[model samples]
Structure formats: structure tokens, C-alpha cells
Target: MTFSIVARSADGRLHGVAVASKFLAAGALVPAAEAEVGAVATQAHVNLAYRSQGLALLRTGVAPADVVAGLTAADPGRDERQLGVVGSTGDGATWTGSFCHPWAGGQAGDGWAAQGNILVGPQVIDAMRDAWLDGSELPFPQRLLTALRAGDRAGGDRRGRQSAGLLVVRRRGGYAGTGDELVDLRVDDHPDPVTELGRLLDTHTMLFGKPDPATLYDLTGPLADEVAALLAAAGHPVGVAGLDGALASWAGVENLEERIVAGRLDPIVLEHLRRTAPPGRTGD
Candidate 1:
């Protein structure tokens, strides 16, 4: 009993999946993706093979449709399976077996494929597709979960909500992480899985995420009022407040660049300071 959104980024450089279900730790079972390959979701008599094989196909230059074809060809029980795939090219597809269960079905579109089984009705898939097209229009993880939330609102996983998970990959680090596996957050078990998933994603994006390096700076000379004003304008009060502390804490340090790099302040805050201050006030 689950609902899932498998998608590739509009620009075709990223791939991700978000899934929620009445099952325990849905994230552990439902989603898989790689930055250079694509994404896959296997649910409703879920087969783990789809995870490795599907990605291998996409990595080997197979299209989404062909990946499904090849996968189904090898799995005689394909008709009883609910699956979704997105290729590196952004091609998407879904399959819902006629014998799946009541209220079971799915939809495929431009860059995403949404599907669910043992739900309230086709509305599950319908709401997912609509939300994907009409939601916040943010990046992949946000958009994908928005679609999943829509399905949850429509009555997801006939068994009820227990867990949710999100996976995203890109060529470079996302708002968090040091590599292409941008977001791999999951709510293994929750009474309100969708809400929990959203909360987790929001928190993950804001706090633990890596800040832009270009915003790092050096604070030389006396603190400038213009610097505070600039930092305020650019949305960083931390840097403005911490300039004196950074200099004082790091005995005799004049440049913000060295202070920031030496762990005197938050990198993101330092980066903001570098950007907002006038030229040469800090390294950009």
C-alpha cells in the first residue's frame, strides 16, 4: 500500500523519488536513484531487482520505456507489480497492474511518473500528477514530495500512513552533502508520514545544509557600518554580528578569509559577509 513519485529534473541533470506508505520504513524499500543514471520505485508486491537492474539499464543508455520493457520481460509477475521509472534524459513511465487492487492506478508525464495502489481511488494518482505540475515549482526533492503529499491527502496506502522517504541526486552537492547524492532523507516511521517528511526536508534544507563558499569573507580593519548594512541587505545577520568575535577569537587575525577558514565562524554566514561587504573587505 503505497504512493510514489519518480522523476528527473526538468533540466535533465538530476533524478529523485519520494514515497509514502502504510508500510514500515517505506523509504528503505521504495526509492532508488543515482546522479548520472535515473530513478526507480517498486511497490505493490515490490521487487528489489528494479533498484539495481533499472539503474543499470539507465546507466547503460537505456530509455525509461525500454528499461521497463526489459525489466518486465525478465519478471513474469510484472502485471501484479506497480512500478515507475525515469531515465537520464528525463523520460518517465509507470505501470499499474489490472490485478493490483481496489483504487489502484497511475499516471506518467513530462518529467515524472506517479503511481499508487490500494488507495482511495484514481484520485491518488490524479492528485499526484496535478501537484507535480501545479505545486511550488521548486527543485526535484520538493516537487516530488509535493506530489506525494497530494496523494497522501487523497488517501494513500490503503493500510494508512506509517513512513516516507526522499532521494535526490545531481552532478554536484545539493543544499547538503559533499557529493551528487544530494538528499537521502527519510522518515522511517511516523503517525503522519507526509507531514513528517515535509518537516524533515524543510529542516534538512535550512540547517545542516552546506552554505555557498563564494559567500565566505575576511574582516580587516575596523568593522564598517556599511558592512552591517550590506549583510542585512543580503539576508545574513550572523556574519554582521560575528565579525568582531571572529577577529577577537582568532588572536591578531585581520582577514575574514583566514578567520572563516580557520573555523572562527559559520562558512555560510562568512560567505554571506563576503558577498555583502564592499570589494576587498572580505575574500569572495
Candidate 2:
């Protein structure tokens, strides 16, 4: 009752899994990834250990097909399990057990795999494969999301949807550059889970995505004064000399310092100021 894609980004800098299923918290059950390692999605009987073990195997330089072989080698119920993997080297492979629900199958290539069981039809995986091919230049997270959307468009789980998720990992892509959960989002139970997951991904990007340096707005003149007033109204008053300090403190508190910078602001940052400034006051 699920469909998923496991993929490595075109640049080989990230790995991701996108999945949707007629199961609660499908996100928690089906997808896993680690930076510089690979990604996996195990469904159709759902072997949770396959996630960690699969990554470990990928990290060991095992080929994606070999990882799938090793995962099913010792399993008593391998006939009921479905798995997909994309290795660090960008090779990919998939397995759909013989006993999985009807319309079950999989397709894989050098950098991606698409698999599903109990799907509406073969079109589900076909659409996902086409979508992944079409989104080669998009951010990995966006590409994965787009693949999920395409699967849904072509008729996804025949049973219906309860949850959807996207998991992407990159070196030092986490908040504050501390870890690698570049994009991890889920809609555990939504009438339109894919759409909802996309919304969460967008919000995550806004809150944490780096702005282009070319678009940064230096805080000076009227912009600085207006920002200072907003800070004061928000309970962080500082005179002109300390305006820069005040903005710094506020940005730290909101976790937007990456885009806000010190004295320079991103257009997103300025828009934030407009949204947070007092009702009757507008930024100049």
C-alpha cells in the first residue's frame, strides 16, 4: 500500500527518500538516510532494521544491488518485504517481494529507484521515474517532493493515503551547520499528505534556507531606522549606535541569523520586518 523513491542527487552531494502510504506515520517507518552514505525505503511488510542496516552496508561500499541481496538473504519473510536503496556511489537498486500486494514492482537506475506495492497501477512508479528524470536540476528535496506529486497524479496507493514524507541529508546542512537533516518533513495523516508535506518543506526552507548573497540588503538609512523601531516594539529597544547589535540579538533569537546576517539583511529578512513591525508602522 505504498510507493517510494530512493535517490542520490545529481551532484552526489545528497541522498533522499520520498514515500507515501496508506499507513499511519509512513514517514517514520519507510525512509532513512545519512550524509555521505545513502538512502533506503522499506515497505510492504516494513522491515525497520533494513533502514540502519542498509545504510551501514552502503557505507561499506557495497553495491546497491548487493545491499538488497544482503538484506533479504537472512530474512525468513523476505517474500513479503520490499526495499530500495541508492548507494553513495550513486548506484541504485530495488526489490519487491513476490508476495507483496498486487500491482507490485520496482524500477531502478544509476542514481534512483522507484517502487510500490498495491498501487493503483504501474503508472504510479512510471510517473515517479519520469518526474525524477525531469527534475535533475532541482534541489534534491524539491525533486523528491515533485516525484511524490507525480506518483500521486498518476494514481498512487490503491488503498488511499494516510501519510507522506521526504527525507534528504547533506553534509553540514542542518540548522547552524551542525548536522545533516537538510529536509525532513512528514504529513502523518492528511487528506492530501503530499501537498501538506510540500507546505512544511517550504516553511522549513524559509526559516533555514540560505539567501543568495547577491540579494542581501545592507541595513542603512531608512531601512535601519525602521528595523530598529520594530525591534524596540518587539521589546528589544536600542539606540541607533546599537541598532546593529539589536538586530543581531533578535536574529539569534529567531534562528534567522544565517539569512539576516549582521548589518546586511536578506529580502526575506526585510519582509520579516514588515510582517513583525507594529500595525500602523511600515518599514521605509
Candidate 3:
């Protein structure tokens, strides 16, 4: 009924999970991670305890394989559960219980695990594993979701798609650097949940992601003039001396405040303002 991948970033500072299932709101139950600790995906009979318990074990420096062993060995329903785990400093591990529906199993390697139950075929897990290996260049959250998408394309839950989720954690990576959650996106229900999940991730990145220093432009000269005009056209006009304040107000309204800088502008934010400015106006 589900497929998932759990992984740690190459530098070992990030950990995450991406999952999709015929079950509703799989995100709420199947995936868990802790920055600098590890990630876990528990499905099939879905032992919810495996999520927190697995992380606790990883926090103690337990190897992922041992975490799986310890968790399942102590459960009477272990034969009906499926699990995958990855620790901060070692290879990942996976387990498919004996009673899980057919076309179920998993694969694991350094820093990653892919697993599923009631899937279309082994190809689902295979595709997920291959994508995880091939996506080393992607951002951690994107890489995990890329693997989930591959499994979906290969034939995900045998029943069909209903929900999807992506979660990534890094130290001080949350909103305003206040928590460990870097990305926690969910498409609780969608006709094409994986695709919808991808779209939400893009929006999340735009609204919450850090601006690239390389792409920031000083708000002086023509660039500043263009922005000022754009703001005015959008009905937040300001005098020449108050450009910064006006830009901040406009960005707040547009929910682009995270990308705002004191005297510099992110190109992405500038483009968004241009695109959203009233049509027939010079800024537009």
C-alpha cells in the first residue's frame, strides 16, 4: 500500500524521507527523521512506534540494521510490518515482513533505503533505489522526492495513489532557523499526488528557501528604480528614500519576506514582483 525512501545527506548533516501510498495521509504516519540522527519509513501493518523508536535508537548511534532488528524482534506483529532505516554515519537497512502482501521488499546502500509493500512489482523499489543513487547532485529534499517519483512512475502502490509526502531535516534549517525541519511537504490527497507534491515543494522552496548570495543584486541604480516602479504599480508606492520599507511591505503581502534583504534584492523575488504587477503598467 506504500513505497518510501529514507536517506542521509552525503555530509551527514541532513536526513529525510519521501513516501507515497494508497492510504490517506501517509505523511502523517509513515515517515520520520531527526537532523544529524537518521530517517525511518514504517508501513504495511505500519508500526507507528517504529518512527520515534527508530530515531531514538539512531540517536544512540545504533546501526540502522540493528535498529530494524531490535524494533521488529520485540513486536508480536512484526511479521506483518515493513520498515526501512538510515543512520547518520552508516549504510541503510530495510525489512519486509513475511505476512506483507506480495510484490513487497526493499533495497539499501550507504545512506539510503527504498522499500514498499503491495507495490506493482519489484521494479518500483528498483527504480527508487536507482533514482536515489543518480540524484546525488540534487538538494536533499528534491533528491528524496525524485526517488519517490521514480517509484511512482515504475508502478507504485498496487491500489493507486492517494497521498504523498517529503520530509527533510537539518540542524537549524527550519523557518527562521528555529527548528530542524527543512522541508515537510504533504499532498494528503490528489489524483496525481507525486506531481502535486513536487509543485508544493517548489512553492515551499520559493517562500522559505534561503536566497543565493550569488544571485542577489544591490538595490541601487536601474535595478532599484525598476523595483520601485514595480512596487508602485502594485499599489505600495514609496518615495525614493523609502524604497526599502516599501519593498518590505510588498514582499510581506506577497509572502516573499524571507527572500528580502536590507539593501539587496533576490532576482527570484524581483521576477515574482514583475510577474504579479498589474498588467498594462510599465513595471508589468
How many Å off is the CA of 263 in candidate 1? Answer: 12
Please write out the lDDT profile of model 1 over residues 173-279, one tens digit for every residue: 65323578788888888899899889988766644454355654444434344444445444344354474543333322322232233332455444445554555
**1-284 in candidate 2: lDDT tens per residue?**
89999999877889999999888999989999999889999999999999999999988899999999999997888999999999888569999999999999999998999999999999999999999999988888999999999999898999888899999999999878999998888899998898899899988888889988899888898877887778887666776648778877777787677776767878887787668767754333
| Number of the top lDDT candidate | 3
lDDT of each: 0.76, 0.89, 0.93
Clashing pairs in 3: none
| TM-score attained by model 1 | 0.76
In model 3, the Cα lDDT at residue 220 comes to: 98
The sequence of per-residue lDDT tens digits that candidate 3 reaches over residues 203-223 is: 999998899999899999998
TM-score versus the correct structure, for each prediction: 0.76, 0.94, 0.97
State the lDDT at 67 in candidate 3. 100
Q: How close is candidate 2 to the true structure, as a TM-score?
A: 0.94
Residue-level error in angstroms, candidate 3, position 86: 0.7
Model 1 CA deviation exceeding 4 Å by range: 174-177, 210-284
Q: Where does candidate 3 have its weakest 10-residue lDDT segment?
A: 275-284
TM-score of 3: 0.97
